[model samples]
Target: MGETPWDKGYASPPLGEFLTKWGVTGRVLVPGCGTGHDVRLLAGKGADVVGMDIAQSAIFRAEAFPAVSRECYVLSDFLDLAASYRATFDWVVEHTCLCALDPSERSAYVDSVCAALKPKASFLAIFFREVSDYSGTGPPHPISREEIDLLFGPHFECVQSFIPTQTYPSRPVGSEEVCWMRML
Candidate 1:
């Protein structure tokens, strides 16, 4: 299979910076964790982190990471895997997953994310934004604050939601970025 363009070779800087500031030492998860870069980052900082991806190729590559060798990577879709471990994580990190799905599926994605976390768990997400076509069909979707409000605000309280100063490394030119934290 051809490579997924979204699997850039480094950790997402915005998410990484947030994890550094927020501290992820307890049970943590990285969903849609292509190549497991952020997974390694969280585990390196002492979180008992697990990474899950829908793509077998991504998981195969992820399993070779030292962190995955420690049993931190799973080959599964984030939405479908929770029944295998109930209320299992204190925190969930959503990188570029939601926007990748069709807008029709976003509600289900939100529901699935909510179901995967422990009660009162925290969720952190980062998005790449540019007023462009790629944003409309993307793993790096461009979402405005309004979209976030419509999608997540009614169900989760905002911990923080703001434009990010730095974009993810290797992100396409002309992409803007936003990061949000919501408490369940």
Candidate 2:
């Protein structure tokens, strides 16, 4: 395959910074983890991380990298996670996963994340709060605070939420948000 527009070739800078302070451990799940960049980040922090992606090529590419710990890559749909993964993860780290889901599938995505985490487990995510799309149609969908509250507030308690000062070079400052939510 040719160059992917979204491929960062490394773990997200914000994620790396967060993990540095998070002291991550236990089982972590990364849905829509292309090439396992973020997956390896948590693994290096001593967490047993699993990276799940729908693309076989992504998994193949991830496996080609030198693993830091018990990190594993799997080819599977995040929307239809395996039974073994149900309520098994202590953390579900989201980067671009949320924006990739269609608006209609957002509920399903939320359900899947709830199912994937143990009770009271944390779900940490960096979401696109605003994008350049005029029609509001996108894989990189922009989400607002009200929409997040409407979608996740019922099932989770917000531990922390903030707008990052540092973001990807292409993204405008304050266009991204990070939320640390715990399962109810």
Candidate 3:
């Protein structure tokens, strides 16, 4: 796989705000962390953050970034993380990862997240609610509240869900939903 155009130089505004409000300060996992912007943010906030990406180039680029140089970057498939990682993370921060996966793999994504998080650990995510065009082909596949509920509801409890005022340029004003959930 090649580098994605979605690899932004900075973390998304919603992610920044989430970190500010939540004060994530323990072991954290950032799956599909392309370029590690989010991982850097979490690590800067005193969390032991591990940024994981399937692409070796992405992990290399993430580790090369001066902002995240001290942070850990792993080249591994999120869906098949090491067994030792199970129930190890205090929090999981997701940005574009869920939307980037094929819709068919969403259940697996949720399972992977559940396996990685500690009991009652928080899962903070910014989901892309709408796509500019719905032609069905996308790295950023469109998602909805119903879909989120269906995928994560069984294993996690929805703590909060709201439309974020701040978002990346690629997403529209109301196209993103910031959801906070806790593993059950």
Candidate 4:
């Protein structure tokens, strides 16, 4: 898969605003954190944040960002995260990561996220609803509300789920599903 242009910018506006409004603090984990943009944003908000990506180059680029110097960045696959990381985060933020995975791997993704979060910890995610012409040929595989609920409901309780008025320029206005769930 080609590198995503998303790898070069600050956190998406909706995500940044959500974290700011919620005042999320304490240990947070960002899996598939392309270049630590969200990591920097979370750290600036007083959250002890760690950004993890399977790509070594992404980790190197993240490490070079002075804004993330005090934060942690790891090179590792989320599905294969170390046992020591289990139940270690107060929050696990999911931005574009979920849609980036193949539909088949979503179950593993949910398992990894659950394993990494503390009991009752929060999982914040923004999922892309399918567009009419979506062909399923992408790093950003389209997702639906039902699929999301089915994948996470067994391990979490839905706290909030809605379509965000704000979204990235590349996406449609009502195409994103934003959800906040607490680990069960």
Between candidates 1 and 4, which one is better according to TM-score?
4
Using alpha carbons, what is the TM-score of model 4?
A: 0.92
TM-score of 2: 0.94
Which stretches of model 3 miss by more than 4 angstroms? Answer: 1-3, 67-70
Alpha-carbon local distance difference test for all models? 0.71, 0.87, 0.85, 0.83
Q: What are the per-residue Cα lDDT tens digits for candidate 1 across 1-184?
A: 2567776677777766675567766788788887888888777777788888888878889887765323377887766765865577788888777767767777788787777778888887776455455635554556666787787887788776655555555564346454455555
Ranking by lDDT: 2, 3, 4, 1
In model 2, which regions exceed 4 Å deviation?
1-3
Which residue pairs collide in model 3, if any? none
Highest TM-score scorer: 2
1-184 per-residue lDDT for model 4 (tens digits): 2566665476766676575557667899999998888889888878899899999998998889896435799988998879888999999999888888888999999999999998899999877776547887886787877887799989999887777766667677777777889999
| Candidate with better TM-score, 1 vs 2 | 2
At residue 67, candidate 4 shows an lDDT of 68
Worst ten in a row by lDDT for model 3: 1-10
Between prediction 3 and prediction 4, the one with superior lDDT is 3
**For candidate 3, what is the lDDT?**
0.85
- Clashing residue pairs in all predictions, respectively, total 1, 0, 0, 0
Q: What's the TM-score of every candidate structure?
A: 0.84, 0.94, 0.94, 0.92
Answer with 1 or 3, whichever has the higher TM-score. 3
Q: Is candidate 1 or candidate 3 better by lDDT?
A: 3
